[model samples]
Target chain A: MNNTDIKRITPKNITDKEFFYGHKACAGCGGSIAVRLALKVLGERTFAVLPAGCMSAVGFIFPQMAFVNNAIISTFPGSASMASGVSVGARALGLKDYKTVVFAGDGGTADIGLQALSGAIDRNEDIIYVCYDNEAYMNTGIQKSGLTPFGTKTTTTPAGKNIHGAQSFKKNMFEIMAAHEIAYAATASIGYPQDYIDKINRAKHTKGTSFIHVYASCPTGWGIPTETTVQIAKEAVDSGLFYLAEYQNRKFKLNKNPKSFFSAKDYLLKQARFKHLTDDDINIIEQQRDEKWEYMREHWK
Target chain B: MSNKKLFISGDEAVAIGTKLSRPNVISAYPITPQTVTVERLSEMVESGELKAEYMHVESEHSAMSAAMGVSAVGARAFTATSSQGLLYMAEGLHYASGGRYPIVMMNANRSLALPWSIYGDQRDSLSLLDSGWIQVYVEDAQEALDMIIQAYKIAENKDVLTPFMINLDGFVLTHTYELVEIPEQEKVDEFLPPFQTPNKMSFEEPKNLAFSTTPADNLEYKYQQNRAMFNSINVINDVDKEFGDKFERYYGGMVQEYRCDDAEVVMLTLGSITGTVRMIVDKLRDEGKKVGLLKIRYMRPFPEKEIIKLAKNVKAIGVVEKDISFGYEGTVFTNVNSALSKIDNAPLSLNFLCGMGGRDVSKSDIYNMFISLFNAVKGEKQKRVQFINMGVETDE
Candidate 1:
């Protein structure tokens, strides 16, 4: 048995009915599930600061509060700033037992919210900022966001015969957070529930700024079958397209290492977004993913 | 307890004041004009005189961020910058204020933006006038040092949960040397109490800070922040008097009006350039010019009541601005206009854009600017604004 396969002990036997019932999450929206699992480990002592995005629009608002603990909402990109304010206020109030979780979407975290997030991390504020990476602005009609992978087709990045969807690679926010030499930063996917929980748990107990980038499949944005959300997430990690790793202040630790190399085709073929891509396109993506995976495997332990 | 009356630059006096303030965290990046203050603080830290966490941040943004962090965790935080640096840290400035951290910062007033040059100006602070910070401009090094010590009390005052900024001119006040009394540490201790964060993480009792704003009443939260800013005006005045009584140094109740009693022509100015204008006002008064000076020490929380009251007494006012409003006219002049409009006997204020991009404003230039105001009062001068020593010959 490996570290990845180790059974994580459940704190208490709880009913499975807690998984947001009759929710409005678009088909395969793994963001809701990710938030649910994140909060399960975070418990009730956490306060989630939500910036305007998929997470805020979907998870919050109205009679439907996806969060159980205290939640604070800010503008489209002011989550980090508000979180900083809350951190100061909480510290001032001597309420250090409670954890401040900053949950934002890709556009909110990677683009507009970048300055405040970077500033917060650099300052090492005792806050957990989780970016639900859905590749695009799924809340705003599937618009191409900063986290949109190089070849994904979206409303903004419409693919054609000559033109591809996005012209750039996915922005590696995990790497950026790692560069700050923060106490803890990890990349996780909803597909790997135990691994995701382990990373969240690690971040919860640590002091200073901790970041977790979770791969949340957007059914509407990615144009995938809603029920296959978990499958897609699992495939991405199993194929080494999205590796699970952790960085504890400059020290790298790979949590899950795929036993053998699985081509990107095994991952992309299942998704409708990549269905239009020819073998040549698939081969190119596979090469890029393998190159990145090899680099991480070689340098990161 | 050395009774040392050293003739030091305003910049150096600020350094002494910062050292005396005993901040646990001092982080800043060097910018034109205000570089000396940080340089001196760095020296003090290096020499073991001040046992402080001195972080050489990459940018003003980082400096403010680091300061906010230190301040968040119950550290007495301080930082200094000017112009571009001020704007660079604009986002952090608001956060610090909202976080209610009594973070004291020194902003060396310099002209901001295009056709940009490193020089004394009020545009920097004026641009961030609504950032929820208590801003105080000092005409000399003495006040720069005195105001900084007082800022902590005013900012940390239980009612006023906000950050404070003491702005002085780059070269005009920061670089220029003057005789300043270095008050005893005991006196400072008595006047400004030891730095204590009201809300911060404590090992004895852990706390969570940086929570999200409650979505239910976020508007009320913003309103509360606004109210806190407005409340600082009175708090600032009260502390100014208390500090003055103890240290014999005060900014005269937040807004210092110099020689403006029963005068028709009032010349308005901020920062060290006010000293030159004050001299010009005295010269004009001796020549029976009926001119006086209204030196604006506090820019944020505005001092609107005092400005409107002062404007009601004066007939024609000349606003000497070291910074321009860009595309319009003067930054201070624009604010002064809004304040006076609320009064019964509002003065005819003229915006004189001068000393921009570090242009030296001499005594003669101030006198010339006042002379133009005199002509305007007499109906002899057609132009409302007379640019003194400004490079131009353009037809309006």
Candidate 2:
């Protein structure tokens, strides 16, 4: 009864009410765009939870709250748990036609908040949990996080003469949610607004727990031109570094299975964080991406 | 009709009280001494005897975090844990209180880890007095049950929206069985009306809660939070009086005094040890020792007025608590000293570190506490924090 019944929406016909606006966020902020768009799809009759990350830090300043709809900041590791609580609390109150959603950063979702997210999914709580992946702990000045990709230079994983940026690759968070046999799971990019907005719509129709891992870019943290955030985000998806996929009914499906991927090398060099990647490092990243797509194409429907 | 009286442990009493209050959500995580409370609650939920969203969370951190979530929607929430679990959710404790969520939690007070014992001690909750929750220690099963109902009423008061923590000494009160009178559901419903607060998220009026604070207004928010705690002092006493009118049982506001008036030597105690201290006072009074007891029910609005009033006529006051500030003195002792410092000639006060890690605070140790205070006035010098009834010797 609490699931969103909103009809199919496109960017041209999206609501201009601006549920989330103002306060402070960097120019061309991908996370903010994802948050604002998700709120638009879910509508004002929704309870949103944000953790102690970039989105919350930027949007929820004292004396100035950016969200017009109801939203609260949760503990760094307890975002999913607190969201689940809001979901149950509404149901207990005999509330009708309201969705509970969470917007957390990569570090908040995959690192400190992983256990809580798993528990909420295990309980099948009626919540649409969105993990906006900017690849590093940007709010804390760009520290390395579990979702930080390989060959990425963060404050914690600085590239040096001996050791490279990050020794290992990013954790497979989307697949991990799929492994839980979650009610609904998907991966999207801020670059593809229609596809990402539709994914939020798909989550609204689901009866139980749903997870969406959206690849949101960080201009300041990634050392990219602010205006190029959407372009780089779309390029990452086009380069096969990030794939759009969905899982439901215990089955995985790729939303965009590219026939021929774009140049992964150009995508990496576009950002300053990855500009430090050597020719050999670029080769390794491309190989890793190709290997992942090979498995995804073979296994995913 | 009056509800039936049953012989039950303090934990069971809490479960009954929780069910009667009809909380909308209960976040449960299991740990020793607190296991029975959650188990009973789970049974009630499973049998459909209690209507609640029973969330068996992964850890204590989520246990508290979830309760705060329930409270954010203006729904009643319940959770329980002991020593290490309490320490684990230490961050959530402050989060809930600062958020002004009137969630009622039962903390089965136990010793913290190091030596790693699962026994009763005040160290767990006492160590976190600054966590901003209103802390109350129950002396017996009846108080445990009664406080569960009253905690919600006091905490949910418009003036005091801080979270409330009800502490029952591990194994002592939590596991020990005693006869408790259960209140009728209809009567309790009348006493505690359905929750209504403008603080919650409602379609009628949307609000942003638990937002970030900057230096420009951070000081004012903290000052307001402190003022709310101060407001709870009267609310605590007033609720007790109202509960007495409705249920015929009353907990003496924050500090319960037993024969402390016109006494020469007084002993201050917290949690379950208050019962034994009362008996010790009774035993000494027969011998004309002029000893008395002060049971500190609430530790956070620190009972400053009660402590100062009880100390005025006493020759010397001794605080027997299960907590230690490690190098300095007992945590409760530190609070008592702070209260006593306000008056001139505050008398010689001593801190007796007894019952550490669930070790027994024998009747003899209590008797000695009274004698030590009496002798201190007689010019027999002693350490401020006396390590009493110890198996190991300490150089003095």
Candidate 3:
């Protein structure tokens, strides 16, 4: 859907009052949209803890938060821990009633904040830890992150005559978190609003730690058009590049069927981040997606 | 039952103490001194000796994090690490304390960063003093065991919902096996109550957790954490006294003074190094040096009143430390200076950085250090800090 039809599907039930609106986000930031949808699904019972990332900087201003309930703490790489503390403290005081949530970017989740995140999960800190994966550290002027997919050009991983974008592939954080044997962990995208909301609802009911990694598109960082944010995000999952799955009781289940898939080129061509790729490069990307798809299907099934 | 006894190392005793408390989960990563505690726990889980989920994480950071997760779910949890492993999980430590997950951890005190060595030093635990944890330093294997059990009681107390770290010196306590009275699980159950978190994720009571802290709520939450820590001071004494009365092991108060009555000189120490000071004090007493040793038990809420009270009658005080503060002085020395500042005409607080990077702090080192401190007091030429008999390397 284009900009004209956006209002129709934007969830009529959601109030126009942005829980964290009127803020500074690069005109079509996926983090902003995802946060909007997340708060929409979770409702006012939710409390948000964000670290030093784009959302922490722009999403919610002081005294006036985008969320309705409560907004507390800002410690880079410690959002999950802080959330865990609030939840645990509430529980200790017989106030076991509110949702405690942590919102972090890929840099905070996959890199620096990995330890604290791991600890919260290990402790089964009964909180929702959301990682809005926009590939790079967009708030820090587009530096590379462990979540940055290979061949995605950034300031650090410059696209040039000899140099490739990123040396390593995007670290599969969803699978890594699942390895901790947490009760609930799944992948979602701003592209599929219904599916994303359904997953958050599912996590709300699940006991122990719940992790949701949202594939958020960055119009400024990825050099994509402001309007096609959802379209690009959907194509990433539809192309089987980013699989949607859940892990519980040491078992994996694919939340979204990958049978009807599109070519990686459909997802790649639309974004400016992959504009430098040639036909041969697209083939390599398609090949990697297929291998990963087969590997996940093998283990998941 | 009154004289229950068993052969145990400091780490093993701590493991036994943890098992007695019946932690629902135990996550652990290996490190020297701290390794044995978790290793024994691993064996317990493997052999069905303990009925709990033992998460063997890839790293210390994950281990502590997992323990926090377990505790968040309204389950009692425990984890242990030492030195580099403790430093690696430093961020997680603050999370546990701040999150108010009463996770009990043990640190086998070892040296800090730079040219890494796995020897006894207080730097690892001391560095984490400001991380909002109820930190208690144990001097012997028995105290280590008793304190581990007490840590849970104090930390999980309704009035003080904070995590705690029981610090014990490596080698001196961890390596040297001793006779520790193994208490019955039934008795432990009666002494330590079950955990009940207020807002847990349950089918009957669903709730959101670890939510974001707004700027206004942030200050109040921090203030609450600090207030909880200060309140824990009284709770520590109560728990320790109650347990000591039941088990005949006295370790409730923060600092324990040894022969400070009418003493002219006072030497301060912590963890297993106190053994050396005990011998030094005995030797100095025979030689009429009027010297005594003040062992710091609870290092975090810092025993401010007790420290000032202990040093009130003394002429000069020397703080022998196993860790350096870097760019300034020793951590214990800094704490002593601050604590003593409150007293009227307090003793001279002399700082000494010694036995770093796992180097042994022998009786000779303590004796000589105390002698120099005594001489400094008599000659009225007191060097604020002494490097002690640390291995020296001078180059042209």
Q: Which candidate ranks first by lDDT, i.e. highest? A: 2
- CAPRI accuracy category, model 1: incorrect
Candidates in order, TM-scores: namely: 0.82, 0.98, 0.77
**Tens digit of per-residue lDDT, candidate 1, span B100-132:** 878999998887777677877777988898888
Error of 1 at B153 (Å): 2.1
Looking at model 1 chain A, which ten-residue stretch has the lowest summed lDDT? Answer: A13-22
lDDT of 2 by residue, B1-396 (tens): 665899999999999999998999999799999998999999999999999989989999999889988999988899989999999999999999899999999999999999999998888998899989999999999999999999999999999999999999999999999999999999999999877777887777888889988888888888888999999999999999999998999779998889977798888889999989999999998998888889999998889999898888888999999989888899999899999999988978999998888899888888888888888989998788888888888767
Query: Candidate 1: lDDT over CA atoms?
Result: 0.77
lDDT (Cα atoms) of all candidates against the true structure: 0.77, 0.91, 0.79
Q: Report lDDT (Cα) of residue A190, candidate 3.
A: 88
Lowest lDDT block of 10, candidate 3 chain B: B199-208
Candidate 1: chain B TM-score equals 0.94
* Number of backbone-clashing residue pairs for each candidate, in the order shown: 18, 0, 33
Ranking by DockQ: 2, 1, 3
Model 3: CA > 4 A from native: A1-132, A139-141, A149-214, A223-227, A235-301, B47-49, B199-208, B214-217, B380-382, B392-396
Model 2 chain B lDDT-worst window of ten: B195-204
Give the docking tier of candidate 3: incorrect
